[model samples]
Target chain A: MVELVVFVLMGGGALAGGVTVIKARNPVYSAMGLLGTLFAIAVLYVMQLAHFVAAVQVIVYAGAVLTLFLFVIMMVGVDKEEDVRETIPHQRRLALALGLIAIGIVVSLVARGRFAWVPVASAAADPQATNGTVQALAEPMFTDWVLAFEATALLLTIAAAGTIALASFRRPVADTAAERTGV
Target chain B: MIPPPEINWFALLPLLVLGLGAAAVLLVDVQMKPHPKWLVRMAAAVLLATAAGALLQGWWLRRLEAGETVGTPLPFSGFLIVDRYAIFGTLLLAAIALLGLGAGQRFIVSLGRRAAEAIALVLLSTSGFMLMLSTPQLVMMFLGLEIGSISLYVVAGFSRQERQSEEAAIKYFLLGSFASAIFIYGVALVYAATGSLQLFEQQELLSRVAFVKPGVLLIGLALLIVGLAFKVTAAPFHGWAPDVYQGAPAGMVGFMAAAAKVGGFAALARIMATAFEGYIETWATVVAGIAVLSMIVGSFLAVVQSDFRRLLAYSGVAHAGFILTGIVAGEAGIGSIWFYLAVYTVQLVGAYAVVAAVSGASSAGSPLASYAGLAKRQPMLAHALTVLLLGMAGIPLTSGFIAKFGVFQDAFRAGFGWLVVVALLASVVSFFIYLRVIVTMYMEEPLEDRVLVLTVPLRLVLWTTLAMTVVFGLFPVPLLRLTAISLPL
Candidate 1:
């Protein structure tokens, strides 16, 4: 009964947040909505007993990424509500039609119980036996997957250097020359 | 307590060299702050050294093949394999990077103080792609793809002076991230269905057991194809290619386009031929359909492009189609696909080098009119462009012809003759697209008094690529022999 109630609350929150993310007229509100959605998903992850993943979901997606989104929105000064005019031709209608089709397909699939064959986590006999803990993850990450883990460092290095190269401006030669002359 | 997996130091030496080179360049850039020319020279030396490491690995592989030593090709707990196929791909990627750096010296220099950053990104991206080609694990491949792609996203926007560059970067990042998400979801679905992430394990499991839920597996396969198709710029998924190609700084556009194609196709071929070899009947038809659409759409759109960069972008789409046709022949056509990629990418880099030289390295777009009377002003560049275009057009006596012929032959043998027919018709249509550019360069009057100049490095890159095109066209036996020896293990 507790599990059912928790599922209902989190799922409903996620859905509401998702809808608000799309419907919000202000960019800041949209970002907040996204944060809510991310938080709700993180809660769902915890409910699934994926504790590490849930923690990462909150710490990374909700914490860092959402903050970055909010920062960019503020930096861009998009505090004002956006114009609600349709930008693309028939975009709304097309979106509505596509959404309807998607929902219909999903509903029909649910109605037909097509997902009945999906194996439940309970089938594992002991969920803890599968070792989805942080230790289990770290073991492979350091042992079998060490090369891939090291490669991620390379990726991060590239990203850091690349961001600097793309965003930062070089000191103008004129300024340096003037400074040298003055000295 | 489980023991750690054994390390294969010898097999990983080339990647280590590349990683060290990237770090060394960054360190030197900060510590010594060398002149731009010295930086370029230092980067070149590092790339050459990395290439030499790959050569040593290749030599070792050859010795192993000759029964001089006993060794298993699978390395790193089956996460990566060091076979002839991986070596061939590594060597090809290294060569392309070397040529790109050589031709892109001017562009790098144009970056002013950020020259080191550009060089570092190139090396890092190459390492990512090299890793991508060597890995058999799906998750590892995804990481490699991200490393390469995220670096490229930044490289595309390196020219901060131009709004178009930023636009290109944003478009590429958004679409590319979407593709990555789709790809990972596919990986998840596949994992859920087969309970394996390793390609070989997946293959073994798939062949042994009849899947209870085949729909999930099939959807996973389709999504994988879609994700990779987006990467390779196959038709319908190629909408971002032209804009990105045209907007990116000219010097590196060639490298970015060529490297992505090489890496994407290598991974695609590996997955399709190895992991899904059991489902060839289903996949071959789907791949053929994509091939036909790509060829027709690419050729038709390329003819209408007035922008030179966009034209090459569309032409690349057509080439992707041609490669896919080779892929439709399954494992039997991997050699032809590699040959086509190796030759076509060299030509692509060389052609874009000319574009870079003519339009200035930092220029965003190359209007077709800029090439009017190019022959009169820069005879060497014009002649080189002519030969390169001819090669791309698949004219006789060019490498493109042999590459096209090889794939078409493989496709024919595999009973994809109808797809081949469509490809042939599309190739004929593409000839006009190349001819239009050539005629503009040779016959039309000069639009402005602009002079075309090629630096020594750029000249060397062009000549080498052109020579390779002709040499491979006439006597493809050497390359063919090498490719035959490098079949996926």
Candidate 2:
């Protein structure tokens, strides 16, 4: 019952936070809301018994990625809300209708279905038999996914360097008046 | 109690060649830079060489069965299939990648720096594309997709000139990542129900499981379709296409649109043909719905577009819809789809080559208005573009028409006469849009001030492709026969 209560709280918190992230008027507030959602999702992951994935979610998404998001928001200095594009009211209504229908379908699926938790046999559970911890993950990471992982790092590095090059090449605007007067 | 299948290195040789080539090119680029401006060209040459090698290897492997060499399912535990179908597709992809390399040279020079990296990325993406075609497993499917997509994200913003390019790149990245994440989650759920990632295994699981599992599986399959359909730039997920295509360098856009769609659809075909065969009735309906929507939306949106690249982007989406008509029809679908993609690659690259040659003293490629006096100035390019436009319209005496005919023929053979009707309607709509460009080129009065300067190499490529398009259209029997044959899904 306690586990069920925790799962419910985690799911509810995450959903609420995600909605707030989109709905918040302030950009900073939205980022904070995203952070809350991310944390809740991490906790939900733990509840699902994906402990390693839960930890990675907390560290990578909530800790590092969110910090980067926060930094970018500050750097951009989004002081006021940008003027909203005047989308048709009917579009909003249509989107809401679609959302409600989707929610209804999902709810019906859950309510009608008798989903039993059939735990996989422990022998079949660990894809890697000898070491089923982080070491197992590492073994595959180093062997099978090594090239792809290296490529990911390379991609991130190149993105960083490219961003820097682009950011640094911002030339100052020439004075039009001075040029006109030949000063 | 059976041991898992062993890895099949020989079957995966094409991907290996592409990967090794890219690494070699990267090393060469880093070592011998700043001295030769043509270092990029040299690397491109190496890629072409690798592509040639892969083609030869593909031919050898494909003919192995004919020669009575032992041929069975690869021991990669069904992660990949080693068959004539995949080999042929890979060979075609290699040729397209090579052509893209040749066209990308001037565009990369215009961008300035990272030319080597861009070339390497293309080769890498080609490798991913090869893997995508060969794979029967979902995990590798996602891996190959990311490899192609991430490369394209960088390639789209290769030029730093316009804010639009940056915006295009970011939008493509964010939307693509989100879609892929959704796809992965769906895969996880499917795996949870099925206990295996292989399509064949999943099919067995689906058959064994009850109705509720099938329902969940259907939802998961829908999500997979949505994600892949996005990659292929089907209408609903095609919001990024036009802006991204316009903002990206013409060569990259051409390559990505053609090769990426081929890879995505290859995997889509595999999924539908194998695991989802049991749910064919369900998936067929959904796929047909998407096809109809995509065809209507893409062609209609393309018709009014002034920008040539953007129009082509919309047209690409429309072609994807047409292709999906075949995919929806199932087993009878695969051959025509492959044949159609080959025709598409040739025609799209040819069109973009013409665009690259024509586009101006201003940017990477030409504007629609810029083509006004093109017939008067650069008759060769105008002629080539006309052929390309005709092919795209599925006009008589062009490869596009042959391809469309093949697909429609397959649909009818598969007992899908109604689908053929819908496809026919869509094709007629597409014809109008494709003709719009040609009409603008010929019938409209030439704008007095514009002068077109055509590059010799681009003109040569254009003319060659135009001839091939007409040739294939006329003598399509051989290709048609080729399309009639099928390999394992």
Q: Which residue pairs of candidate 1 clash?
A: none
Candidate 1 C-alpha lDDT tens digits along A70-127: 8888987895655788889999899999999999999999999898755344313445
**Per-candidate DockQ vs. reference:** 0.40, 0.08
Candidate 2 local lDDT, B1-489, one digit each (tens): 223334445665666667766666566756766422365556556556655665665566657757856655554545667665676667777777766765665775654456656776777777777777777778877877877777778777766555666777788889989888977877876787677888888888777765754666777888899989998999788898888878777756777777888888888888888887888888888888788788888988988888898888888988888898888768777888888888888788888777766663114434688777667776777788888888888898898888888778877776678878877887888888777777777776677655555554456567667876898899888876766664554
Clash statistics: count for each candidate: 0, 2
Give lDDT tens digits, candidate 2, residues A112-175.
8845543332333454443324455676665544434444543453454345434543322565
Alpha carbon lDDT of each predicted model? 0.88, 0.73
Candidate 1, B1-489: lDDT as tens digits: 657778888888878888888888889989998877678788788878877887888888888879998776777878888877888898888889888887788999877779889999988898888888888899999988898888888888888566688889899999999998998999998998889988999999999998776999999998889899999999889999999999888999999999999989999999998989999999999999899999999999999999999999999999999999999988999999999999999999999999998898977999999999998888899999999999999999999999999999999999988988999999999999999999999999988877677888899999999998999999998998887777777
Q: What TM-score does chain A reach in every model?
A: 0.73, 0.62
How far residue B358's Cα lies from its native spot in candidate 2, in Å, is: 2.4
The most accurate candidate by TM-score is 1
Enumerate residue pairs that collide in model 2. B359-B365, B359-B366
- Model 2: per-residue Cα lDDT at residue B328: 75
